[model samples]
Target: MYNIQGYFEVESVNEATALLAAAPHLLVIAGGTDVLIKMHHGQIEKAELLSIRKIKSLQGVVKLEDGTILIGSLTTFTQIANDPVIKENIPVLAEAALTMGGPQIRNVATIGGNICNGATSADSASTLFALDARLKLQSNQGERVVPIQEFYLGPGKVDLKPGELLTQIIISPENYRGYGGHYIKFSMRKAMDIATLGVAVICKVKQGNILEDVRIGLGVAGPTPLRCPEAEAFARGKTISPETIAEIGKLAVKATQARTSWRASKEYREHLVEELTQRALKAAIVKAGGEAIA
Candidate 1:
């Protein structure tokens, strides 16, 4: 049972923003996957919820005239996994979406909620980091765009200001174009489990199997989802060989600040970061039309 104080259903961004401005204590709820569970556990008591589920503008996937992809905040994991535009332009995100929980959960878990919850283990975080995604935040005052990397303040925390809501997730063409990407979630179980470690790799392959560029993102490895810049810098302009991948894997470990938890030991998570980085990078290389390294 929830200790409810109030519940407000909003129909548009403007309405939601106005409500938020008036009731700063109101917690924004979309899918309620994380919020309801917390409320049920007494983590949140006497909570006032402002539901954004009825806001149509905050739903669906759209490709803009500039070729950028705009994913509305309320877009579900199931919708992301099956969307033709997402699959064609950013299949890595789709793959991550499919690995989240089970079918029923995916159908109701909005990407907005997942991101707003600010969990490092969230399946989509690493992929979004790798893609250099940006967030569009709106308020009754106005709107602003923030780079995804800057959005996370700490574990279970984000940079949402009072009266502001995440409206859309934006991925520019320069980030996804010509890049083949892959996401690997390391968990104890194949389903209904959070990632102990998640790895996402995106790379562009040049002639003769050289890596034109590469980006690696890791989740549950630090206070927030992080990119392995050292490894990415090392891989850029390097030939995609077994030796190169091995070195890159080791370098990727430097980016992690993993800590022991009930789900995994710090050492074990580090091992996954290294090993899975190699595997994910290899798969991404292949997807980018590079030869597979044995």
Candidate 2:
């Protein structure tokens, strides 16, 4: 730890941004789920605090004047998971929220907190990647909307400036159509455990045989949440049969090998991603009014 400090809970994004620009290395706090853990464990550099929890504008669900649904950054995971609008409009996101932490964690931890942390295994991000989520960054300078896939620069990093705050998540109306999705996370236990591996697969089913617009993204399988376009292309338009699903699994492993460099060799991770992806796809297919392809 670098040093100690008190909290400054600013009520507005502009206020938070000004505070951030002034502080040399302030660790922004929201919900305090992750920060408090690091503060207790001495894992994070010590610094002054800029808390965004009190910013009310950052805590609501809004369907904009346009058709896009705007999810406020400070909206808790529980809010997302339980919101009927979210469940009806973007159920995959709601499903992802359910897997975040325990109920208490879901109550306090915010979506902004998850994205800002930028961990590869961040459950929210992996799901969002498949949804083609867009993030809004607000600052004293201005605001910018960045596609979620491009928002992350590296692990524990994002494309944010010193005075920037991720203020909103935008999901387009086209993405609101019902689809099958599964977010499977591998951890030691079911609750309150970080994922060792996680997979999210979302796709539309057509004519009971063809797979259309398939998306496969992984958590803890890359430096940032990654979509396997190659795997997706190979899987799309294919029959949802077991042999075909297995082939898609293999392609997913091939996609991972193109990027991952592992000391343990890519075999195990590839296997996990493939297995998890297949399981996830099976679950999703069931939800999409189809039986598992056996």
Q: Estimate each model's TM-score.
A: 0.99, 0.92
lDDT of 2: 0.82
Please write out the lDDT profile of model 2 over residues 59-141, one tens digit for every residue.
97887666689999999999999887788777778888888989999999999999988888787988888888899998778
Report clash pairs, candidate 2.
2-46
Off by over 4 Å in 2: 1-3, 257-266
Per-residue accuracy of model 1 over 16-119 as CA lDDT, tens digit each? 99999998889999998999999999899999999999999999999998999999999999999999999999999999999999999999999999999999
* Candidate 1 residue pairs in backbone clash: none
Estimate the TM-score for candidate 1. 0.99
Predicted structure 1: lDDT: 0.95
Give me the candidate number with maximum TM-score.
1
Q: What's the true lDDT of residue 107 in model 1?
A: 97
Q: For all candidates, what are the clash counts?
A: 0, 1
